[model samples]
Target: MTSTSTSPSAKFLTAQRSELLSRRESYLADMARSTATALELTEDGANQDMADEDGFGEGDTLNVERDRLLVVASEAKERVAEIDAALARVDAGTYGACEACGKPIPEARLEVVPEATLCVNCKTGASLRRK
Candidate 1:
């Protein structure tokens, strides 16, 4: 995609891309660690063969912890995916624009969420729909 040299949005996105990439890497590392921890916890929970009911509570706690870890990993994975998509938009010269309405995303929103592809209105609508 051809990008105009004078476009402030393009420049801003280019400047922010490196930071987003760094964040994406961090998220990926976190995901790996969380997933590994979750898997280990799950295995440990499953392998507990204690016949005593006293140990059952501990096993349940382990399972709950494993689930929490898995949720963290899942959220990390989603963040990575969002970062990747944002990077793609940067490459396509469409960064800082809302994907839903084709409007320019506000600088404030971009600063808060560099991977955001929707403006506040669109995002709010989508959030409400999800609820």
Candidate 2:
């Protein structure tokens, strides 16, 4: 059934959409900050002269920080992509359904993880298979 103003499903989907959009914006901001920090660290490392021992240590530290920031940025980007996919599912009227089992995902679980594509049982099974 399609979402209508009077339907509880419609309200749930609307709430999910709002939460997903908020999370997407937060992740995007995090990615931007992390990327900027990484870039700055890279630039700082490049500007340091590596001929001296202290320069070498400082540069190494900067490189390590940059790597960490890059990882953070990458994770944020991945989360943003997931959130985008969730938004797409919302638009397609499949937001509350499990992709793997075609069952309705619990509201509690959805409240905790708005981007979840699989229900708990399927998710557990998938995780077990991966291991």
Question: Number of the top candidate by TM-score?
Answer: 2
> What digit string (tens of lDDT, one per residue) describes model 1 on residues 63-98?
889889989999999999999998898887778878
Can you list the residue pairs that collide in candidate 2?
Answer: none
* Each model's Cα RMSD: 3.1, 3.2
Model 2 TM-score on a 0 to 1 scale: 0.88
Displacement of residue 113 (Cα, Å) in model 2 is 0.4
lDDT tens digits, residue span 88-107, model 2: 98887778788888888888
Which residue runs of candidate 2 sit more than 4 Å off their true CA positions?
A: 1-8, 50-54
**lDDT (C-alpha) at residue 45 in model 2:** 83
Question: What is the Cα-based lDDT of residue 18 in candidate 1?
Answer: 84
Q: Give the TM-score of each candidate.
A: 0.85, 0.88
Each model's backbone clash number: 0, 0
Candidate 2 CA-lDDT value: 0.87
